[model samples]
Target: MEEKLTDRMCPNCNDYLFYMEYNTEIPYEGNITIKTYLCKSCYYKDVSIKRHDMEKPKILKLKIRNKNDLKTIIYRSPDASIKIPEIDAEISPGIASRGYITTVEGLITGIKEKLSLMDSHDAIYIEERINNILKKNSEEITLIIDDSSGKSKINSGRAEVIEK
Candidate 1:
């Protein structure tokens, strides 16, 4: 099921083309609500997911040791935090943070894309580390997803779940 909302204005374009979609049947997130936002005027988009069951919070960890591990899929809530200590990378939720589902490789690639937008020396160095991870050159990178709301998860048997 889905609900369409269109009574909002785009923050970027200040146009009345902002829309939201609420979905109830997202895979791997049983009894969860997924909110998606889009702005037709500015081409802005975002997604957030929350569990209706209100389960306990959890910290999920996955070790990426081979190419198959990079194919692991995960759903990240807007309030979740992602960390890869191997690359000294951490992504915490902010005002503009959004949620979505993607593979481990896709997540790392997304980080690389964001880092590429920066002009600082640190960003370039981090981008190179991210490249090594993406190229499967890094040895045993650990992917951590901490979600206080327990709305994020790794959809693989290899994932380690720590209830908090």
Candidate 2:
């Protein structure tokens, strides 16, 4: 079932935001609830996934060897952390973090975009490294998603999951 509630004030802009929740059943994953909040005023948005029957936490790793690997799908939970050791960058889970579903290429592009908004000195080097990976000009890069909530996943056969 789906439930929707709107008019919630956005923390950033004090504007009305829309909130929606729904439950879905996956073949082997049982019941899961998804909640989404969106604010058109300040462009604030967040998505969260919760499993009715929670499972053990796990770490998912996918090595991007070539361009094909960049097409791999990734579903990242808000409670998960993303690390690209090759580029020396890590997106830690915190209040600022958000859940998202995107491809490996999209994830890398997002890193570049976020870094572009920052004023750090090392942002240039990190952006260059990200570009090399995106252009398929560098060695293999590993994308790691550490999810304590056990809700994040890389939808690819090449993805390795290590249970914690």
Candidate 3:
């Protein structure tokens, strides 16, 4: 692993901020670069990850039947589009989007957090429905990931992959 740190001017304030970059290799996976920015003056932070290897476009689908399914690991690339059709929720890659690996439950939680930020009536309703699903009180949900970079994957035998 290699790491670097530099000072940058904060966008909110003219104060100096810390910019960090790291390059690391994961076993069975390719090399990745992680970049982070932190501004102490404005308490702002941002993080993103990029894979070094090129990949083909692909789509992944997974069904969540029970609590055990929530523990399954999911790797999402920055260019991937995540969709939960049951709830009519979708997250597409954007300028501020970042790549990360997390469990199914964590993904739902992340979605809830984003919805909460919207402060809209529809967002709140969808968030509540997602929470019910997370609690296993609702019907099973399906997770679909369309990755143009093909770096995203669901680490489970139940996951279906289709090359685009």
The candidate that achieves the highest lDDT relative to the unseen native structure: 3
User: Candidate 2 lDDT, tens digit per residue, 1-164?
Assistant: 44355768889998887887888886435688878898878889877766686668889999889998999888887778999998887899887576678999998898899998988889988888788878855878899999887888898998999999
TM-score rank, highest first?
3, 1, 2
Native-referenced Cα lDDT, model 1: 0.80
CA displacement after TM-score superposition, residue 123 of candidate 2 (Å): 0.9
Highest-TM-score candidate: 3
Q: lDDT tens string, model 3, 10-79?
A: 7888677677788888632489877877787787777777668858899999998888999999988888
What are the TM-scores, per candidate, against the unseen true structure?
Answer: 0.70, 0.70, 0.71
Q: Give every collision pair in model 1.
A: none
Please give the range of 10 consecutive residues that has the lowest summed lDDT in model 1.
Answer: 17-26
lDDT at 3, model 1: 37
Please report, as a residue range, the 10-residue window in candidate 3 with the lowest summed lDDT: 1-10
TM-score of 1: 0.70
Q: Candidate 2, TM-score vs. the true structure?
A: 0.70
Query: lDDT tens digits, residues 52-157, model 1?
Result: 6655789999998888888898899877999999877789988767668999999999888888998989999989877776785577799999988788989889
